[model samples]
Target: MTVVTPVAARVTEGRSLTWRVSLSEAADADMSTMFVVVPATAPGLSTKDVPARWPRDTAGAKPDPERPLSKVDGLYLFVDVPAGRTSADVTLPTLGDRVAEPAEPVRFRQTDMDTGEPLPDGLVLSGSVLDAS
Candidate 1:
């Protein structure tokens, strides 16, 4: 099981996150896991590494208040599933390692976060859609 930072009623963009991720087996079937700090926030990096710095207004329209203004920076891990690429289990410390809010699932057929293009072959993971929270 994963402990995700529950999405807030009004989570703002540019907010920072802390997180850690591992396999369910690593938890020994128990979800009481501790958090490892996110590496991107550590020293020796330039401003380019910041997630909050990702462009938000490039679409020529104000961002939907519910959408992320930048690439969300959070703690995450990839778990090996059978015969496929790793699936990301993201952990957000800003919200206590809870998953994105609204807890809604989305398919990649939805609009792209970047150019608003229809995501080709879209999101295959639970995180593809974020909650309205």
Candidate 2:
């Protein structure tokens, strides 16, 4: 199982997330091939929007990486936010299907990228979705 630890929330263009991800259950799984579930409305804030100073090799820094963003069924985004380097622009693209009324505040679910299934444990991170529009 994978656990998500949301560190902080900030607003740049939209909701930005600084979180730590790890595997709670050790398995022959690829960390790179994982997905984080996010609100469908915030795809723009993925790794594509982080500033240069972000994710520096500092003491508090997590192993963050620039990941590709894609929509899943239009209700949520299967985001590829890597673990460790702890910073990401949590904005999502407004494409495809959408929830009529998304629940608040924001939340994340760790899942297998290949199977699109949850990590088979209580791996969740729930927090506010700061909107700096």
Candidate 3:
């Protein structure tokens, strides 16, 4: 899994901001699941943390993105689904629903749903506005 990018900013003032974050397979083929993580080489990698579940609707926001951890907005990790495959499934390794923004570097990893093999390239760590509530 990849971290995409570490967010650096103070918590929003006044009202809280809602952030809709997504971490999915960025490859052309369908991936069973994706991971958001700080690379082992990254300074503050936490093996106990779990990535946030990505929303399926890639075109628009279905559920509002705002949440308590919305401060770490603009960071996304993704992969594309392969042909003949149209579904994504992932097993969360920890209890945390969303990973906290790391104080150091990180990356997202796409893996097979069954085999757990790393998906081919096309992964990225980008700072793009996803959607907001």
TM-scores of all candidate predictions against the true structure: 0.19, 0.38, 0.28
Q: Which lDDT tens digits does candidate 2 get at residues 1-133?
A: 4445556533223444455554554434334533355553443333333333332321122224534222222123333434443323333322122323222244445566566665665355545333332
Top lDDT model: 2
* Candidate 2: C-alpha RMSD after superposition: 11.5
What TM-score quantifies how close candidate 1 is to the native fold?
Answer: 0.19
Please give the lDDT score for candidate 1.
0.27
Backbone clash total for model 1 is 7
- TM-score-based ranking, best first? 2, 3, 1
Q: Candidate 3 — which residues are off by over 4 angstroms? A: 1-32, 36-41, 47-102, 125-133
Error of 2 at 47 (Å): 17
- Candidate 2 contains a number of clashing pairs equal to 17
Residue 115: error of model 3 in Å? Answer: 1.0
What's the candidate order when arranged by decreasing lDDT?
2, 3, 1
* Candidate 2, superposed: residue stretches over 4 Å from native: 1-3, 9-15, 22-30, 36-103, 131-133
